[model samples]
Structures are given as C-alpha cells and as structure tokens.
Target: MKRGIVFIATLMMLGSCGIFLPRPEFEKGMTERRFLRQNRDAKISNLDNGKTTYRVDRGERFFVLATFEDGKLVKLEERESRPNWMTPQEDPEKRNR
Candidate 1:
C-alpha cells in the first residue's frame, strides 16, 4: 500500500510538471508554415523583419498585416479597401520653368 501511494504521488507530481504532456495536433513550426501557405492568396508582401501583409477578400475587401518575432506573432495592422490611383505627372521641363 505504501509503494502504491508513492507511485501515485510521483505520477501526480509529473503530471503537474507536464513531463508527460500530450503532443499538440500540429507542431508550432509546421502550424505556422501551414497557416502562411493556406493564406498565400491573401498575402500581399513580406518583409525580412518578419512582417507579412495579407489582403483579405472579405465582404468589402481589406488588408491585414502581421509581424512575428522569434517565432511568435507580435503585431497586426489592417486597413479597409480604398482606391489606388496615381495622378498624371507633368513634363519635367514644364515643372522646371
């Protein structure tokens, strides 16, 4: 009985310490890559600083960007859809006059 009690106590301590923790369904590295690939269409650009911009095609269309550092997601930025237009440029000579 004493041996059984000790075993149970040890098991409880190990569980609390997460020594026998179950493996996650998707590992961290794989999960991050999968997420990025699955949403590639929404990706507009990526930066070496670990920042990525995604263009979500939701109801009104929007842009979402996120930053990650040290394998951890850190920041997110988003903006609503807006027209992207450029104004006509005058001749350089005219502008110099």
Candidate 2:
C-alpha cells in the first residue's frame, strides 16, 4: 500500500509541474527564416516596415497570427478565419469516416 501511495503521489507531482511551465509561442529572437523553416505552410504577409504577419492554421480552422519585427518574433495572437465565397479553407483535424 505504501509503494502504491508513493507512486500516485509522484505522478501527481509530475502532472502538476507541467501546468506551471512556461509555453512560449516561439522562442525569443526567432528570426523570420527560422520561423518559416519551422512552419513551412504558414502564409506570410508584410504588415509594415520591419514587421510581418504569419498566418498558420493550427487546427479546427484556428488560425494564429505570429507577428515579427526586425526579423524577430514579437507577438502571438489568435486570428479567426471567416469562410467567404472566394476564400479557401483548410480541413479540420478529424475527418468523417
């Protein structure tokens, strides 16, 4: 019984530790080329001087806009994609079987 209790306690600690860990959208100082390499299918648009937007659909039509400045990533935001008559959309993660 003691061994089982210890195992359960260890598992709980490990699981709880994960919640406190920092999750960065992209590592600091990540360059534009590096970002493109990591996200090949990501669409890039020039927002302004030394700034750009990377549109990447993670899943379920949830597009993310990663903004970069001076070739370095600066901000991360979620962008909602609206289905329009002329726009194309990506398939969701699950498919009807």
Q: Which of the numbered candidates is closest to the native, going by highest TM-score?
A: 2
Candidate 2 residue pairs that clash: none
lDDT of 1 by residue, 1-90 (tens): 999999999999988888567544223333345556655555555667665533445455576665555554555566677655444668
lDDT of 2 at 1: 100
Question: Candidate 2's error at 39, in angstroms?
Answer: 0.2
lDDT of 2 by residue, 1-97 (tens): 9999999999999999999996654776788898888889899755777689988897855788888988888888887766566586556754543
**Model 1 residue 24 distance off true place after TM-score fit, in angstroms:** 17
lDDT score at residue 75, model 2, on the 0-100 scale: 86
The runs of at least 3 residues in candidate 1 whose Cα sits more than 4 Å from the true structure, single-residue gaps closed, are 1-31, 50-61, 85-96
Local error of candidate 2 at residue 94 (angstroms): 40
